[model samples]
Target: MERSTGVQAYYAESAERLGEVYESVSFEDVHGALLDLLPEAPARVLDVGAGTGRDATALAGRGYTVDAVEPVAELRRVAERLHPGSGVTWRPGALPEIPGVRGPYDVVLLSAVWMHLPPEERPGAMRRLAGLLAPGGLLLITLRRGEPPVDRRMFDIPPEEVADQGAAAGLRLLRTVAEGADRLGRDAVRWHAVVLQLG
Candidate 1:
């Protein structure tokens, strides 16, 4: 997939800043709405666009095997160094065409990544993600809402759009929560999170 230079630079040039933001985020906070849907311990997890590996590291600490796919080189380097031996295998990959990452994961997570794709790309992306799920697997995605920042590439993606895409992908909607604030305390930013169960 061809990535926008702005999106590339936003992550690469601002790795340090993004690292600090990701460092403060917790898996519990982000996955609270979908906890009940997640499988039991020792479940295989795939965290796509896993920034800084914070959530992957946390889940790995609790005995889950995690495959964290981070496409950014600098962030992957920092994440590996920051959370080594956490039972999390960090792979370099991205969405819509998640190359180099195998799936059938018990849980698939996409934190703050859904909005990065253009509206038309969502259905195919969701289909690809759904195909990666194990039976009864859960797919959790958080869509960033509100106006996009000047530094990065994003759309003010709506939760309904995501649900529609998921439905087209043959995923059953489990939950939809639209009240999360920015973990970095960005007032201009908020989140729309969704949980889907694959057939």
Candidate 2:
């Protein structure tokens, strides 16, 4: 799937920033989230918009078969280098149309990629994402909710909006974990990690 102009810019900036700190970002939260959904053994996992392959590589190392999808060429290259011989199938593509990876996957991860999608495209994207899941498969999404960047090109949706989108996509919400705080103790930059069961 061809990305929109806004998505291209968002990815370009993320690639640049991630290149510098790709190795340092903690994967504990991501790994724990995935493990919580698939606790017994290795399962087919799809890491959507897998920038730098941090989560994908970690899952592969733990014996899971991961299909990592990244649209940016530079990020794909970085992921390849970091996960050499890690058995991770790297695909060049964006959300809703993952190339070379067929699913029905046990888990589909959309970490930190939701905000990059334009509001108008979000519903279709969510439905397409849910379509990739196997029966009883889990769809894990991490939404960053807060003030939008000054650019105003992206949509910073609230957690309620995220839940609504999931329902519209035929996904049943299983749980939600929200965190982060603003200056006055109000939640700012809320990281809503939601679990959904595919219908």
Candidate 3:
């Protein structure tokens, strides 16, 4: 929960709009590259920045136990309302220091949320993410690349940088989908999925 105040406010005020926009894309479509890498059902999964519970709900439907962490209150409300009885627990939290969450999850997912962490915080954040994983657990991180929006804070983090940081945190690089077209059809935006594993 160490993100800046402005980012928090932005998500809070835009939660409704964001919920609609985020849910427009199906989980399979958004995460197809790494879908096969997900652990089987009954495994514990943590979805950070789980806006509107799109992925969390979908994962729950697949029979996995999911804990969804969202920083904005409005988004959590929207998520619960949109997917009632989804079997996914929703909580307020942020990166580098996720509070109130019991970890050692089989899978940890961060979709389109890592860019907000300032460069200096990435190493620490990577370590924290690593610590949250169980032995041989998977850490799936989706990076949004290209120019950032004018209104919100973002960084164009390279995949190599993340891989290096993960390695420094004792994670082994497992897979890297170099780039994919933006599902939202934004020409300026692309995505990269980096999967790491703890020994």
Strongest candidate by lDDT: 3
Best by TM-score: 3
Which residue runs of candidate 1 sit more than 4 Å off their true CA positions?
none
Off by over 4 Å in 3: none
lDDT of 3 at 99: 73
Which parts of model 2 have CA positions greater than 4 angstroms off?
13-17, 30-34, 181-188
Q: Better model by lDDT, 1 or 3? A: 3
- Per-residue lDDT over 118-190 for candidate 1, one digit per residue giving the tens place of the 0 to 100 score: 7667777888999999888889888888888776778888888788888888888889987668767889988
CA-RMSD of model 3: 1.1
Cα displacement (Å) at residue 89, model 1: 0.7
Candidate 3: tens digits of C-alpha lDDT, residues 1-199? 2478888888889999988899999999989889898888889999998888999999999999999999888889999999999999999998878877888899999998888899888898899899899999999999999999877788898888889999999999999996678999999899999999999
RMSD per model, one decimal:
1.6, 3.5, 1.1
TM-score of every prediction relative to native:
0.94, 0.85, 0.97
Q: Give the TM-score of candidate 3.
A: 0.97
lDDT (10s digit) by residue, model 2, range 1-199: 2376666666566765665565576567444544566634578888888888888888787788899888888788877877689888988887555556678888888777877777777888888888889888888877767776655355677767878888988889888876453212335455667788886
